[model samples]
Target: MLINIMGFLVSYVFCLIITPLISKLALKLNAVDIPDHRKVHVKPMPRLGGLGVYLAFIIGLIVIGFPIMSNIQVILGATLIVILGILDDIYILKPYQKLIIQFVAALVVVYGHVSVDFLYLPFIGTVDLSVSIIPITVLWIIGITNSINLIDGLDGLASGISFIIVFVFVILAIINQQDTILMLSFVLLGSILGFLYHNFFPARIFLGDSGSLFLGFMVSVISLMGLYKTVTVSSLFLPVIILGLPLMDTFLAIFRRLKKHQSVMAPDKEHLHHQLIKFGLSHRKAVLLMYMLSATFGIVAIIFSKAILWGTLLFSLLVIFISHYFYNYNFNKIIHFLNRKYNKT
Candidate 1:
C-alpha cells in the first residue's frame, strides 16, 4: 500500500515537472495542433504532451519494481502505440495507416497472452472463445483505442474522463485484491492528473494522437486485466459501463455518419462536446459536464460490481433515462404528462 502511494506521488511529481519540458520539445519538433473549422482551439498548440505521461508512468513503474515479465506483453504493445502516436502526430498518417499500426499493436498485446479467452453468460455459464478470442481481443483493443481518440475533441475532456475511469479501476482492483493492477492504476491516475493541469482549457499543450492513443491502449489493457478476467455475468457489463461515455459517443458518431451516407472514418464537428457547445455551454463547462457524466458511469460500474444482476438492471434503466433526458425526446415528456394526470385524478 505504501509502495503504491509512493508510486503515485512519484508519477505525479515527475509528470508535473516534465510536462513543460515536453511542451517546449513539442514546439521544437513542430508537433503542434493548428486549429481549423472542425477544431475548438483558436491558436496553434504544442502536442506530444503524452511524452510526459509516458515517461512518468514508466519511471513510476520502475520505482515500484513492477514485474516486467508478468506485463511485458502489455508494455511492448503500449510502446508500439506510443511510437505510432508520435509518428501520427508529426506526419498526420492516413486512416488506413493508423489502422494497420493499431492492429499490429493489438496483435502484440493479444499474442503476449493477454487476450480474452472466455465470457460468463447469464444462463449459459462460461463460454470459451476458443479460436475466436484472438480476433475478439484484437477488435476490443482497437475499438477502445479509437474510442478515446475520437473523444479527444475538447481540452482536458479525454484526459479528464480517463482519469475518472482509471480511478474507478483502481478502486475495483483494490476490491478484487489485484495488487499489480492497483499499482498500475494509481500510477496512471497520477500521470493523467499531472498532465491535465497543462492540458485543460486555454491549454498549454495537447496529448495529440500519441497521448490519446497511449491512454486508450493502456485503459483497454487495464480493463481486461482487472475487469474482464472476472467470471461473473455482471462483470461482462462492468467495463462497458465504466467506459460508457466514450464508447457511446464513438458508436453514435459512426451511426450518425452512416445514416447520412458519409464515411464513418471521416471527421466532423458534430461530436457530443461540440453539441454541448452549440447548446450554449462554454468549453470548460462542457468538459466538466462530461467529467460528471463519466463519473456517473463509473459509479454505476462500481455498483454493478457489488450488486450483480440487480445492479445491471438499475444501470440499464439509468442509461435509458439519461439518454431520453439528453435527447429531449418525447418519452420523458410523456412520462411527466402521465404523472401529472395521475396526480390530478
Candidate 2:
C-alpha cells in the first residue's frame, strides 16, 4: 500500500516537473501540431508530451523498486511504442509504417508469456485458445493502440478517458488482489492526472502520437495482465466495456469509412467528439460528456465483474439495443443504403 502510494505520488510530481521541459524540447525540435481543415485547434502546439509521462512512469517504477526483469518484455515493447510515437510525431510516419512497428512490439511481448491461452466461461469451464493466442493478443494490442490514437482530437480528451479507464483497472486490481496491476495502475493514474493538468482545455501541449499510443499500449497490456486471467463469460466483456468509448469510436470510424468506400486510414471530421461539437456543445462540454460516458462504461464493467448469468444476459440485451438505436440514428444514411442493397439482393 505504501509503495503504491509512493509510486503514484512520485510519478505525478515528476510528470508535473518534466512536462514543461518536454514542451520546450518539442518547440526546439519543431515537433508541433499545425492546425488544418480537419483539426480543431487554432494554433500550432508543441507535442511529444508523452515523453514526460513515459519518463515519470519509469522514475516511479524505479522508486518502487519494481522487478524490471519480471516484466522486461512489456517494458521493452512500451519503449519501442514510445520511440515509434516520437518518430511519428516528428516525421509523420505513414499509417502502414506505424502499423508495422506496432505489430513487432506486440509480438515481442507475446513471446514473453503475455499471450492469452485460455478463457474461463460460465457453465462451460475453461476453453483452451493456445493455437489462437498469438493472433488474438496481437490484434488486441494493435486495436487498442490505434483506438486511443484515433480519439486524441480534443484537448485533455484522450488523457482524461485513459485516466478513467486506468482508475477502474485499479479498482479491479484491488478487488482481485492483483498487486502488480494495482501498483501499475496507481502510477499510471498519477502520471496521466499530472499531465492532464497541463493538457486540459486550451492545452499548452498535445499528446501527439507519442502520448496517445503509449497510453493505449499500456492500458491494453494492463488489461491483459489483470482482466484476461479472470475472465468469466460475464466478465469477458469487461475490457471492451471499460474501453467502450474509444473502441466504439474506432469501430464506427472503420464502419463509416468502409460503407463510404473510403480508406480506413483516411482522416475525417466525424469522430464522436466532432459529432458532439457539431451538436452545439462547447469543446469542454463535449469532452466532459464523453468522460461521463466512459465512466458509465466503467461502472457497467464493475457490475459485470460481479454479475451472474442473468446479469450477463441483461448486458447483452442492453448492448444490442444500444447498437441498434445508435446505428439507426447516428449513421442513418449508411444503414438505409445497406438495407436497400439487401432488399435488392
**Model 1 pairs in collision:** none
- Candidate 1 regions exceeding 4 Å error are 314-318, 325-345
Estimate TM-scores for all models: 0.93, 0.93
lDDT of 2 by residue, 1-345 (tens): 899999999999999988999999999989999999999999999989999999999889989988878999999999999999999889999999999999999998898788777787767878899899999999999999999999999999999999999999999999999999998889988899889999999899999899999999999999988889885775567888899999999999999999999999999999999987776667887798789889989998888888787778887798789879876785645435544564578
Task: Write candidate 1's Cα lDDT for 1-345 as tens digits.
Answer: 899988889999999999999999888888999999999999999989888899999999999999977888899899899999888888899999999989999998888888788787776688888889889899999999999999999999989998999999999999999998998999988899999999999789999999999999999999988788889867778888899999999999999999999999999999988987776667887798789889999987887887666656776787789888867875445445544564578
Backbone collision tally, model 1: 0
Model 2 error, position 146 (Å): 0.3
Q: For model 1, how big is the CA root-mean-square deviation?
A: 5.0
- Per-residue lDDT, model 1, residue 53, is 91
In angstroms, give how far residue 48 of model 1 lies from its true place.
0.7
Best by lDDT: 2
Which residue window of length 10 is worst by lDDT in model 1? 330-339
